[model samples]
Target: MVHRMRLMMRIGRSFVSILFTAMLASPAIAQTYTVQAGDSLWKIAEKTKAHDVTVHQMIAAIHENNSALLGADIGNIKPGMELAIPSQTAASNASSKHATQLLSGTGSPFSTPTRNTRIDSIQKKISHIENEIEDTIEALTTSQDSFDAMVTP
Candidate 1:
């Protein structure tokens, strides 16, 4: 009886160890998200809370996982469309791989302008508009002068 008990204990320990290992080895199951009105990929990614990945990475993972449903246009998601939210580990892996590509100067799916860049862009546009206004005033003055000369004669 003593020998049998020890053997059974050993078997139980082995079984527990195997179960734990299998659980860790398996990938996390993905959850499904239903698209809502006014929901964009960016908004969905932001609200999903996938840890260890940026919103861009989450967006890319979502697009990759749901390519069949999303098709070529990521922006065309409509209300009631279901999306598989990638597992946290999957998103982390995808984002890490994508981050390397992005850091190496590869293109990103989205671009966010820095404050300075936006300010400079606005300044340039303002300068161009001012130049256009000045040219218009000069043209109008020239026309008026021509009219005055003709009327005086």
Candidate 2:
């Protein structure tokens, strides 16, 4: 009976350890947000609390997540709208579980050299992604136009 008790305790400990490990290792979850009248992207971003990606970083994510809000400018998003938010987990995971989230765009005017460097790097990435999106949009528009031509004639 003592041996069985010891084995049960050990099993319990192992299960607890596994549960803690899983909690630590889980990916950030995604969330959905709605825009309110007078609501801004910056405000919504403030709520998301993602580290590496800013509210702006999510313009792409927003469009991808909420198919209904397409073509709306991220910078000038209106209120009374709903948006998809990235789980803090996914954002953290995207940065490889160790990546620090980006400093908020509203950081102090006294920016450090490191901040400048990071901004440059992020801007480059954003530019690349924007170019890709534009190319895709162009391709899709072209296809649509061609199809329209084909169907009309």
Candidate 3:
């Protein structure tokens, strides 16, 4: 009887250890946030800082997790959209990608890569791009005018 009791105690300890290990190994379940009126992805991300993610990261994570619901443009998000709040690591990665975009001047509406950029540099870049676009449009309009003039009676 003593030997049997010892064996049962050992088995119980093993079972408890297995249970504890499994609980620790399980991944954390992500939380969800529903979009509200006048809410932007930036704002939602700001609120989700409680989850320990930066606003930029939160925006990126929300965009990635809800691409189907949000469609292509992050700026196109609407009221009542349900977004998944990603884990901290995932949010960090997303924010990194967004930061890259910002640095490359491909910023989304919710975020500008200019967070670290000098204000004067941003203005100059914007001015340069605007000038290039205007030149292209003017050239195109001139070519069209020439074609019209030649084709007319």
Clashing pairs in 1: none
lDDT per residue (tens digit) for residues 16-78 in model 2: 999999999996565667777554444555567566665444533444455356333334345
| Residues forming the 10-long window of minimal summed lDDT in candidate 1 | 97-106
Which residue runs does candidate 1 get wrong by more than 4 Å?
A: 1-19, 22-27, 95-153
Off by over 4 Å in 3: 1-22, 25-27, 50-52, 97-153
Q: Which stretch of 10 consecutive residues in model 2 shows the poorest summed lDDT?
A: 96-105
Off by over 4 Å in 2: 1-5, 17-30, 51-60, 92-153
Per-residue lDDT over 10-76 for candidate 3, one digit per residue giving the tens place of the 0 to 100 score? 9999999999999999978878888887666666777885456666677667778887876655656
lDDT of 1 by residue, 15-80 (tens): 999999999999777699999976766668778846667876886688778879976556657899
Model 3: residue 147 alpha-carbon error in angstroms: 74
Q: Clashes in model 3: which pairs?
A: 102-113
RMSD of each: 18.5, 16.9, 17.9
State TM-scores per candidate: 0.49, 0.39, 0.49
lDDT for each candidate structure: 0.72, 0.56, 0.71
